[model samples]
Target: MVYQGNDPKSNDNYRAVFGASSAPFVTLLEELPDEKRNLRYSLFCDNLFTSFHLLAHFKQLGYEVTDTMRENRIPKNCPIAMKKKNRGSRIFIRP
Candidate 1:
């Protein structure tokens, strides 16, 4: 769908509808169905919209979201382990 910022009547400016100072996506989520308001739904979004704040918001709503984050965006405390040999190498990351 096209977001016609040129059309003032069109609520295409998310920042305007959601508010610039809002905790990011609060306004965006408000448009969701009332039944799904506080339920656990898996949200799959693009990397541009992924952030800890967004995830926390989803959690607050009892929902979950998934997206590929930049290396720097990942929590540094997560664990990672690796074992040798090209023939048999075991690399594991425990969340």
Candidate 2:
């Protein structure tokens, strides 16, 4: 979905439906038809739309999510190694 920018009412509506912490990308997923939403599908998104909480939310709903996340988005206590340390190594960290 395209965000027109600065729509307080739309943001409020999304928050009401998806909760206060919901990102706009969550709204895109939530806007899917009920039938589509019920299907357990794998979704791919970019860092701009990815977050640990978002992944957890989708996982709870039986959907698979794969996306790149910003380093700062990683939980401080997560066990994943830093980029330089993990370079050239295969490290898979699941949310």
- Kindly list the per-residue Cα lDDT of model 2 for residues 2-94, writing each as its tens digit: 755554645675555544544666766677899987998888778776677777878888888767777887899987766767554545545
TM-score of 1: 0.49
Q: Write the per-residue lDDT of candidate 1 for residues 1-95, one digit (tens) a residue.
A: 22223433334454454233332455546666887666667766565656555556566677666655444545677453222347444442223
**Deviation in angstroms for 35 in model 1?**
3.0
TM-score of each: 0.49, 0.68
Q: Give the TM-score comparing model 2 with the true structure, all chains together.
A: 0.68
Clashing pairs for model 1 are none
**RMSD in Å for model 1:** 7.4
Give every collision pair in model 2.
none
Cα lDDT, model 1, residue 2: 24
Q: Give the alpha-carbon lDDT of every model.
A: 0.51, 0.70
